[model samples]
Target: MERIRLTGAQATMLATLYGKAMDARSPNSVLHDTMALEAVRRIDHDFSKVGIKPGDASTVALRSLHFDGWTREFLAAHPEATVLHLGCGLDTRVFRVDPGPGVRWFDVDYPDVIDLRRKVFPEREGDYTLLATPVTPAGWLAQVPADRPVLVVAEGLTMYLREEAGRELFRAIVERFPSGQLVFDGFSKRGIKLQKVNKAVQVAGATLYWGVDGPAELESIHPALRCVSAVSAFDLDGFDRVRLAYRLLAKAARMIPVMRRMAIMYRLEF
Candidate 1:
């Protein structure tokens, strides 16, 4: 089995990877990412240390599914568009979305995380590239073709960066692409302040910094950027599939405006 030695926010990817793996193993798998399941088997780490319960598995898978759905929608319209998946970690989205040969897919992350990805995941064929670099203000953006429409997706990545860095990252993507969409999950300020109670944060000893109460906050990053859609976490596709306790939590989250904003998925068009 492959041993994991990642630390900080990078290390949190393992818990999500394992959560998706557990979801794939379940009878009512939300994302059905069998590749995630396989990756977990190849890794030597004891995932139990992360404390990913069945509810967490469902939550992770559901988030992935929502992002997958958005990607599918974009690809169906522009099959040849370039896909920029920032902070990719160990996610198998390239496999999950399975875009056409014309769609160039780039998975960006730190060098060590990319190295771990290469070890656990199989080599993908046709128009797929793994970029080993931090996404923020990096020259790595030069590697992506600027002509085609771009679909930028960042899952479980925001809030890790300071607000300035996060806004700059958003500014960079909107400025780089002529036309396309950016989809990501964001937490509210209260959520970031209350993050110490989060299991994954405890496991990885990670830090949270940026937070936005709404998509309007993201729009200020670039003049061309426009809010397309904003969906709360509990309102995602597989809400019913999650256990009742999680469903109740979602219902409760809905009542509190800040809590509702705490787990929002936003899509913006430029």
Candidate 2:
């Protein structure tokens, strides 16, 4: 089979589908919930036309929802705060969160993704801008106003970065903005090792290169960095219709703690 350059929307579609596949039984799970699932279904249909198979499609979909939930929660409290979504892909978070009139939102990604996004979504005049540039390069920070409070979110992008680069990115955000918050998903060291053996991960072009054993690991990156919360699918609350087996597994993972090595979202305040 020939290799295809998957667009950001295509990758996001896969992440959403993966979440739906894993938690299809949980009515409260984002994948099992409302409009987001419908969006995922639409993306999956598009992926099918492009010859993307079900398994790969689902993995990306799950990852998208996982980050989407975290991003939505953070934006809820800081609606007025500026939101910088790194490696945003084609996720409709700005619409999902609906920052209203005052909040400033910037979606940063590679040029190709931005190009496609403009065509796919309507361009609103105020409160949003699509930035087409590599996030790692310097000078992009100047574009954002340092006066307002900021929240930087990195969803599925961190795992692809090396440890030093990730740390530098964290430091840069803290240094650039006077005060803000960050929420990003990270894998544990064991998770990194396991990915090497997981054929499923290999097929998706994913590798768990960055890992944080616990909150302290994130805090150690900078003294100003404070871990407000760490969450896993198992830690999520408010599910009325969870299955017995799944509930048991989630509870067991929390009790053991070691099971958190799989994947956890870290919320940091600076």
Per-residue lDDT tens digits for candidate 1, residues 38-92, read 9989989988887587667998998998899999999999988999999999999
Off by over 4 Å in 2: 1-4, 7-13, 17-79, 196-200, 238-248
TM-score of 1: 0.97
Candidate 2, residue 247: Cα displacement in angstroms equals 4.1
Clashes of each: 0, 9
1-270, model 2: which lDDT tens digit per residue?
112355432244344433444344343443443443444444323433332343333334455555666666666776677889987766666765667676899999878767756655557667898889877754687898877778888876676667887888888888888888888888788777776655434545555577778899899989999998788746654322345655567677777777855778788999
- What are the TM-scores, per candidate, against the unseen true structure? 0.97, 0.76
Clashing pairs in 1: none
What's the lDDT for all of these models? 0.89, 0.66
Q: C-alpha displacement of 46 in model 1, angstroms?
A: 0.9
